[model samples]
Target: MSLQVTTIMLAVDDMDRSKQFYKELGASLGQDFPQFASFELAGGSALGIYPLAHAAADAGVPADGSGFRGVSFHHIVDGPEAVDKTIATAVAAGATIVRAAESAGWGGYFGYIADPDGHLWKIAAA
Candidate 1:
């Protein structure tokens, strides 16, 4: 079977805050609701944000958890300069820089930031 991912859903404590952050990162709003919000991303992929408590309950898991989810979302940009600019923009939108943009060991430039709900995102040079 061939598997393809068209959407990524994040469990957020505050939907409004998460939605605003993604908007600042250039995602266009799609469907909006009190418990959920969807955003259209590049390449036809989509991002979904839902209430953490509801998500956990729906999945039959505990809602209380913290620190490193062991996964990160990546955004590719045209070049190293764009990486820096993206990082700055995220910070201005209330995201915390987990790592400063710099040369990557793989010969690219990248940085990481955590959104209001602590989801990690990597802004990398394409």
Candidate 2:
């Protein structure tokens, strides 16, 4: 059988803040609840927002994770211009600009942004 990751869920401390952040980035909200939310993303995938405490309980793990989680969400765009625009928009939407947009050594352009919960997103075009 084949597998697919249709939805990516991010555990956040503040639901309102996180929801607004994603909304500003053009994510259409869906299945929004007090402790959970879902956003429609490109390519038929979806982005899920959940409370950190609830997530930890669901996973049976501690909610004390800190520092780089050794994972990043990579967003592919049509071109460099799109990359820059997305990063800029994310920053303006309460996301911290982790890295400025620049040319990549692999003949591409990209940048990085961190959400309120420190979720890293790599905006790139290849």
Candidate 3:
């Protein structure tokens, strides 16, 4: 199969709040629908937020519980300060600062934050 990801969808508990969170990170609203909100990012791709229960139903699953899921979205920046700035912005926008910006042992600086809907985001300068 020749396929490329055209969009990344996050199952959000609140679409409006999620849209605001992404907007604070420099994304602009691209589409707004009854059950979904899409954001146009720097690149050509898009970010989608949909109600968790509705999304799960559309995907043929029961949204009765939660788990780590271990999915992380990475955002690459130009330098350590950029990483720090991004993390700070995310924090100010109501994201949970999972890891404070710092030098990584892997020859770079990085940090992590969880969006309003608990999606993990890694900001790195490498």
Stretches of candidate 1 off by over 4 Å are none
Tell me which of candidates 1 and 2 scores higher on lDDT: 2
Lowest summed lDDT over 10 consecutive residues: which window, candidate 3?
A: 61-70
Model 3, TM vs. native: 0.94
Q: Better model by TM-score, 2 or 3?
A: 2
Query: What's the lDDT for residue 123 in model 3?
Result: 96
lDDT of 3 by residue, 7-118 (tens): 9988998888888889988998988997999988787898888899998998998887666778899999999989988899999998999888888899999999999877
20: Cα error in model 3, Å:
0.9
User: Which pairs clash (backbone N, Cα, C closer than 3 Å) in model 3?
Assistant: none
Scored by TM-score, the top model is 2
What are the per-residue Cα lDDT tens digits for candidate 1 across 1-126? 999999999999888888889898789999999999999988999999999999999889999888898999888999999999888999999899999889988999999998998889999995
**Candidate 2 per-residue C-alpha lDDT over 9-92 given as tens digits, one digit per residue, 9 for 90 to 100:** 999989999999999988999999998999998689999988999999899999999999999999899999999889888988
What is the Å distance of residue 64 in model 1 from its true position?
1.3
Model 2 clash number? 0
The per-prediction CA RMSD against the true structure, in angstroms, equals 1.1, 1.0, 1.2
